[model samples]
Target: MSVLPRTPPRVARRGRAVPVGGVLLFAVGGTAATIAVVWWVAAHTGSAWSPGGDLAVYRDAAQAVRAGGSPYQVDRDGYGFVYPPFAALVLTPLAVVGPLAGYAIWTVLSTLAVPAVVWLLVDHLTPAGDHRRPTLLAVGTLAALPLSPIAGTLLLGNVNIVLLALVLVDLLRVRGPQQGILLGVAAGIKLTPLVFVVHLLLTGRIRAGVTALASFVGTVGVGALVLPADSVTFWAGVLDSSRTRPPGEEAYGGSIRGAVLHLLPEAAHGVWLPVSVLAAAAGLAVAVWASRRHEELTAILACAVTGLLVSPVTWYAHWVWSVPVLALLVARTWRRPAHRRWPAGLLWLVFALPLPWWVGYVLGWAPLTEPAWMMPVDLLYTVTAVALLVLAAVWLRRTAPAARGCPR
Candidate 1:
């Protein structure tokens, strides 16, 4: 069976093309710039910006589980373990080492996940026979490492990259009946990835969807068997607080819901929920439309973007999905006429800049400033997400076969 549909012939019928050497040189230069910026931030911030504070939290949660305590209630440095019970169980091996050692180990693993995800995206998105695929993956991953969202994930030692790799591997690499298991495992670790289950169902991969759902249920069953009380506590709304954005986090939280709360009055925060519902509806409709056109990657990405936008508390670290989005945009633009590919170049510049969470960093900055100036800066991430969603719709329509009608 075909691993992926062939790139539309029009993509291969290119006219003027970008010079590969220039692209590589620019990528290397961008990578160096990112390193300088990260080094500057680390030096200025000192240990306040130390790596693995979040990994340390996960380590403590794992230790709690090992000691027959409730991992759900475990908190370290005021950060609670917001992941599912199975995640704690999975991390239990870390308890063998001290927190510092665990941090080092997690940092190495998470760092490696960066390039791994890059390879997965490049390998799947580009033609299998393209010689430049390795170079593309290397340049993309190097450039991505310095981006605020991806860099922040590395600095904080989060599992978002690992989760991203799992989803991409399931979609782009996996074969046979077990294809969806990794996706389910990812969703079990963090609930946000369940959006892929919806994607699979909409795309008519019923068996794979059922397999993913069962794998998720299997994780819950394992948790129940190992720690019955904690399982009950987690499944109930009690552990919901674990996933809630901390008070004062909304300013730079970057989700549409978070942006809505920041821009509106306190009472109007309730409006975010309804707005999120509408966004989810629209985003999912786009995903379904892409799926109907046999654009599997586009469908999956639409769902991923939707989940990020609709979630109440998507932090900068959770934007690892942006890496895949960048790869897709670059690929799409590579296939376009030379003059029409400016969006790809503009977007790369946008992602390369340090994300401006400074307004939030400077307390009361929003209120002190005029709405005209502050509102756009505050909603930068949300705007980027909406733009990507629009791009996905445009690409779907442009690439859809003439025989297939656009969704109404």
Candidate 2:
């Protein structure tokens, strides 16, 4: 008789399975609550409250475009234009609907899209056969509700969410031809997202980078062709306006640059250029490391999120990109035993603590003039960026050996 080989005792499965039903209930409840709160605020605030300053500018530009007037030539109190002609063209339809209605529709759609996008990013990152789907789903919901920047985006009626979605989707599907088109669309809407072009280039995705550049050029070319004479006027006006406007006049309160200036009052107007240059250099360094390390998509996503925060001009709503970063944090932590839970908890706290502050600011409950207590917002942003960089550095250290295997 052949002796049967003794099987090794199965190790106890680590981490608990998430409850799907509970996650669904929390998501639905949280979404409903968020909508209700926003609607109430909008109704109560009425004309006394305006969306973020950027929204006002965009709305005016939309109206200008719709009135058979050129947005490029229309100087709103000498506030120079920054957006391209393509933005005005896109806003034409919204202008027809009126700013309030357009803002309402955008807020609703963006708020709903936040969780779905977070879920997609998380699903893409997590390994298959993990029994942590419920935990991941719950985490996604929390991210969309608490830590994510959707609240501020909705409250401010900002376009950052749409730009963010386009950028995230482009990064997620960087291998596709459509990535170039999407990147172009994002850059056309908001110029800052153009940084991704550099990211694509440094990664040796030369064809994709070229395609992105071509798409951007084609977009501007078409816009110029359509607007023709007005395009030149608009470009000139924007450059002049951006230079002359002071921070207070520009309503820079909610941006990283504004926050920094708020905390360090001495640097007020002069900090933007230096801060922008430093952010660019840091971003380039991170992108180079990511390329050399052959880092995972999650690591790349983290880099992108960190890059945004480091930028001097980033606003609170733009933090919506952090949803994916938080998702990655949760998914990674969930895979390990209970003893490894601190990182996940810290991530959640960092993501959650700022929601109330953002909401308070948007609602006018937390004015920027209230002494230096407001400095925490800037500090929090700085901490978040540093943490993400640390995470990427650690991951790079671990993957360096594996990445060396690729042919030089």
CA-lDDT, candidates in order: 0.72, 0.62
> Which tens-of-lDDT digit does each residue in 80-170 have in candidate 1?
7787789889989889998656766676677667778887877776656655664676687776776666777766667888899899999
Model 2 over residues 1-408: C-alpha lDDT tens digits?
001111233521544445768887787677767767776766665432234345556677777777877765545444544678887887677677766677677667767776667656655655444455455565576557665356667666667767777776776656666667788787876666777787778777777788888888887887798787667775656534334343453324334455556566677568755775675576567656766665445435645654565454555556776676666665556546788868767766765665665456557786544224334654576657756766666766674333442211
TM-scores for all candidates: the values are 0.81, 0.78
lDDT at position 127, candidate 2? 43
lDDT of 1 at 18: 45
| Total backbone collisions, model 1 | 0
Q: Which residue pairs clash within candidate 2? A: 80-241
Model 1 residue 36 CA deviation in Å: 12
